[model samples]
Target: MIIGIVGGILQGMEAVYLCKHAGYTSLVIDKNPKAPAMYLADRSETCDVLKEPERAKQIFSECDAVLPAVEDLEVLEFLDSAMKEVGKPFLFDLESYRTSCSKEKSNELMARLGTPIPQPWPECGFPIIVKPSSQSGSIGVSAVKNEEQRLRALEKVAKLNDTPIQQEFVSGKSVSIEVIGNGKTAKAYVTTEVVLDSNYDCKQVVCSSNILPEKDDKEFVEIGKALGEGIGLKALMDVEAIYTKKGLRVLEIDARIPSQTPACICAATGINLLEELVCSKLGKESGKVRKDGCAIYEHYVIRGSALYTCGEKEFSHVEAPEYIKDFWGADEAITDFKTGKYEWRATVIFTGKDYQDAVHKKKQFIKNAMDNCELEEYIDRTPEMV
Candidate 1:
């Protein structure tokens, strides 16, 4: 099958990587000619869908399905209309996306559904999270401990012309689960632990059987189902939460294809989310069963003589990276690493039969990268409060 993926950045790279694993041909589209995913796809086109709707439609007409990897509402709306006119399945849900884009709306919806979430500020006291209601990732987000910092955080959100959402700073293991629905019913997939960098941006994903205790894991899946069905989701969406001693506290929802977690889940389990999404749209089943396995997906940047574990935001700047098998002792990697280059980046993935085995392999992979490059130090930073 040929899958047309729009917006070749982080999400685009994910779609292309999944397509390769599923044995599907990927056709990446982006206005930026040097977009990273453009180099990884089986085929690529440089065209802005909003600027040239007809051209975009023509390009997508050749593919079996079209998937938008962008968060821009205007661009996503254009592709939705263009794909419909071309008579191809567009893998997106505009209505659900609109709801998920605003934290206020989604938070209200989750509240109505009795989904556990961080308490609103003033009621929850100091050391809260203040962030823009409409921003994605760690943009315009701040962890404020007092009124002074709260005002600063609000000002930051105001600068973006977006509303601020302040909630109690929930701390625990950051977890994520993906759900797919057909507007009527939904199914939740594997649960993965999300590791964040000091910037509160995701730096790694660990997928294994024990990400959550059996009971909590089951509850997490149910929460995903409830949210997907609540929004009447028609495509794919991921629910991120903090698994605290009090239980799971949902952070936010994104009704779009995510990057790192899906790759880690695919490596650890036999299931392919993109393939499952496609099969569901076709009224069929992928028939792939989950396996008892473990996988670690992490990103790194080599600058000067030191190797630093970086976040997805930093890795997004990768230039013309290639997919390498057995990269630096890891199972596989998507990297821009070139011998003799003082600066480079890589997203390395490795799998094992269990969590301990995976951890051992991950350490070995890091050691290999440091030794092979003759690096002076290996640095891994984490958020101060998470």
Candidate 2:
């Protein structure tokens, strides 16, 4: 099948990767010809959908389905309308996306559903998280310990012309689960652990059978289902949460295709989310079963003589990366690495029999890179509070 993917950035890269795994032809469209995913797709077009709606519609008509791999509301709505006019299935939910885009709205929905979430600021005390309600990832987010820091964080959000959401800083294992729905019902997929860098951007995703305790894992699945059904989600969405000592506290929800976790989940479990979504649209099941496996997906940047474990933001700077198998010691990688290149980036994937086995392979990957590149140092940084 030919899948038309819009917006060739991080999420676009993700859609292209999934299409590759599912044996589907990917056609990536982006205004910038040099967008990272443009090179990775089977076909690519350089066009801004909002600027040229007719041209976008014409391109999408040739594909079996269209998927919007962007968070911009304007672009997404344009693609939604274009897909509708073209009479093709658009793998996105605009209404659910409207709700999920704002932390204020989604937080209210979760609260009404009795899903655990971090307490509101002032009520929960110092060391709070102040973030923009509409921004994705770690953009315009801050961990503030006092009134002064809180004010500064608020100013940062104001600069983006966005509302600020203040919540108590909930620290624990960061976990995520994806859900797919057909409006009436929904299904939750595997859970993955999210590791963040010092800037609070995701640096790694670890997927395994034991990401959460059995009871918590079940609860997490139920939470994902509740949120999905609560929003009447029609496409795909992911729920992120912190598995704290008290219980599971949901962080936020994004009613769109996510970048990192799904890739890791696919590597660990045989079930491909994109394939399942497509099957659901056709009133069919993918018939793919899950396996008790483990996988680690991590990003790294090589600058000068140092190899640094980096976040998605840093990795996004990758230019015309290629997909490589058996990259270094890892199973596969999407990287810009070339022989004798002093600067490059890679998103490496490692799959194994269990979590420990995956970690062993990950260590070996690092060692191989160090030896092959003759790197002086390997650095991994983490958030100070977490």
Candidate 3:
């Protein structure tokens, strides 16, 4: 099968990665010639898809399905409409995207559905996290610790004229699960734990079996299904929640193929959401998706100055260069290695018989990698936190 993927930036890489593993050909499009996913795609074209959507559709006309792997809402709307006209499996739902686009809307929906969520702003008091209602991936997010900090964060939000959502600071391990559906049918997969940097932005993902407490499994899966059914989801999506002592506090829903979490899920579990979503749209048989073992995904970069790592895991979705395969127990390596360059970044995936085995392999592999390479100061991604 062939899939036409739009946007070769962040989320786009996973679409290509998943399809490649399934042995499906993928044609990727992005305006940037060096868009990270370009090298990994089976076929790639550099084009302004927003400007030349018709051209994109023509290029994608023969594909089995068209997938939008972009974060830009406008771009997704266009792709959804264009693919509708093309009469192929356009694997996204605009209404669902819109619902998840605004934090306020999603929070209200969850509350109405009787799902636990972070308490509202002042009612929950200081140390609340404030964020732009429509942003994703912790962009334009801030944790206000005091009245002064709250005032400053509010001013920052005012400068952008964006609606800010203040939620109680939820202290717990952040976890996300993937749900695939077509409104009438939705299925939630195993959970994956999110690793955060100091700024609370995702740095890596730990995909393992039974990451969620067995006690929370049924309720957590129910929350995902409730959101999917409420939003009438028609494709793949990720539901993020904080596993608090009380229960899973619904954080926010991203009604699109997420950038990092999905890949790790496949690594740890044997399920591939992309393949299932595509085949479902095509009305073809997609076999069961289940937990196979464990997988860990992390990122690092090598530059002439020093080796640095991505603040956003999988930020560099490149294949491993032949010179860089010293690490053992690595199930797969995708790196962006430019010729004669001092800088390069690649995401490495490792699979093991079980969770403990995978964690051990990751630690050993990272130790081997960092020790052999000359240390460049850690690539500190300055907090985009407001």
- Report the lDDT tens digits of candidate 1 across residue range 1-386: 99999989999999999999999999999999999999999999999888888898899999999999999989988888888799998888999999999999999999999999999988999889999999998899999998899999999999999999999999999999999999999999999999988788899999999999999999999999999999999999999999988999999999999999999999999789999899878878999999999999999888889888888888998999999999867888999999889999999998999988888888998888888899999888733322
From the highest lDDT down, the ranking of the candidates is 1, 2, 3
Query: Model 2 scores what on Cα lDDT?
Result: 0.92
Evaluation by TM-score, superior candidate among 1 and 3: 1
TM-score of each: 0.98, 0.97, 0.91
lDDT of 2 at 216: 99
**Model 3 over residues 311-381: C-alpha lDDT tens digits?**
56335444433222434446676665555566667677877878788778877766655555544455545
In order, the Cα lDDT scores of the candidates are 0.93, 0.92, 0.77
lDDT per residue (tens digit) for residues 249-336 in model 2: 9999999999998899989997789988899887898989999899999989998888888888888999999999898789989999
lDDT of 1: 0.93
Report clashes for each candidate as comma-separated counts: 0, 0, 8
